[model samples]
Target: MKRTFLLFTMLTTPSVSLADNAVNVVSWGGAYSQAQDDAFNTAFEAQTGISVNMVDADDPAVPLQAQILAGNVTTDVASLGYSDATRLCDENMLMLIDPATLRPAPDGTAAVDDFLPGGLSDCFVATDVYSTIIAYDESKFPENPPDSLADFFDTEGYPGRRGVLKEPRFTLEMALMADGVPAAQVYEILSTPEGLDRAFAKLDTIKDDAIFWEAGAQPPQLLVDGEVVMTQAYNGRIFNAAVDDGKPLKVIWDGQIYEMDGWVIPKDAPNPDDALAYVTFSTDAQALADFAMQISYGPPRKSAASLVGNYKDTDIPMTPNLPTTAQNMANALAFDNDFWVDNLAQLNERFAAWLAS
Candidate 1:
């Protein structure tokens, strides 16, 4: 069950007309970008005679917003974080996705059921899954690695500097988990004001020993330079750092926060139909698996897991980051994007205040 998309770029011709036959996509820049460029962008063009103009972006939200507000919707499809997608949805800045047009299952059912609940909505569909976990320098902690988030904050026992993401969502959840809340109860505990305060109080205990990482690429560098023995990081970036530098690093999947990025169609997009086709094609099981294998991000498509090869006799599928097994994924928490979307500004302000204090 491979999902295929036609990708064509007008490389040779500078003045190609895209009015009727092309789709414009905007996406984050990284290995993910390369994989999409290789798999979908190339294939889509070869098959459909439709050229794709992919706009590489470090932050696509502002540009997308500007384009939409200006009534000059150049981007037909976009890959955005859940929060960004929600913001666009709330602003009525995106078009509703029609799941009926998606590739059908072997049983003749719509493939929409293959996606995780809350991972997609009327206006967006999840494209990839990434985890934020405790990544440690394996060389430094060769004998005994930190097994869980609890050990990450156990300074007296581990006895080293640690790093945590500067964002409040995962950081607060990690703090709550460290304070002994079970993985299943994390979100329930943080939904109330008292619970939020409790998590912050627990975080305050580790504040002095924790180095706050503000950027996605910073934690890996901090780990490589020995600035911190353990830090919270995206599984992909840490894995890339380790493979690139030949450094020994291990990710503790226990209590990891699994977050997803989604494909969203901007409101008033020039080619909404083609954008829908592109999204459906990109999420096909085979294409999803191919992209995941090239990058560390996991695909939400149910069949994508089977496409991954086995590293050993273990049932776990081999990926660039740690294997995403049923057990590992079972304990993983899905970050609440709705909560984050509603509270990001205030929570970020509070986080900054807490950091300064």
Candidate 2:
């Protein structure tokens, strides 16, 4: 397996003791990392005096797993997708988190009740909800745009290469959705062999015209470079490309799949106490809302939802762009982390085989 090197550091305060005054945190880079740094790390340092060394990765799970197996746990706390957190916890690769340690909502609600359903796990505490949505270059489809998952798969009508992430997770979910499977029944249908075949069969429609992207940055770039007319992308990345970079892009919220990203500590972290403190502070309602103000991600706390109204430096309402918003949630799939945890290895094996065939 290839390892992602996290090559960055933050030395805001000049006095940090290597022995007990520092903890390392890892996250995916780009605008999302900037949001976390602004929302959590700096304030965390100010409150606790534990200097945070910020590390960046394509996917934090990759290097985190490497550190766990190699027995040199340099990352004190790392942000992870729910499935990775659950799977790693099952394998004893992550430290089990106790929700009791977390600070309650400002209204005096308990941590467990304050977080979104399924947001708390044995080893991780959720930070935000982000989605993988279909986006197309608006310049390519000014008159007739891709409005649905079916449009995304209809290359004959849309008439260009489609960009998809090079992974089984969302690709399989999307193929199933495009095949007319209801969002509520995706996992139920995927559990059967016939269903898996059906999803693969649906994917075969655009297989020849699809360009697979391995990184989050590639999808919007593909759209911008005119390499693809439509692609699956993280909403924040596409939003930044459109608003910040001035790329003409349109997002299709139909059949979007949303999942949680959260904080988890390694079982043998050097600074476990500081790691817990940071996560507890970072996931509180205000802090999560503060994160949304910097990026388009949806804060997972119900209280935080009300606090998200406008993006920083722009008058754009962050609500409509969020995956958890009422409008977007109508036809969305709340990613079944448990389903993926149980079937990922098997499905991934089949997906790899099918790809090579």
Candidate that scores best on lDDT: 2
Taking the candidates one at a time, how many backbone clashes does each contain? Answer: 9, 0
> TM-score for all predictions?
0.87, 0.85
Q: Of the candidates shown, which would achieve the greatest TM-score relative to the real structure? A: 1
Model 2, residue 274: C-alpha shift (Å): 2.3
Please identify model 1 stretches exceeding 4 Å from their true place: 1-19, 105-109, 310-317, 320-324
lDDT for position 284 in model 1: 76
Candidate 1 has a TM-score of: 0.87
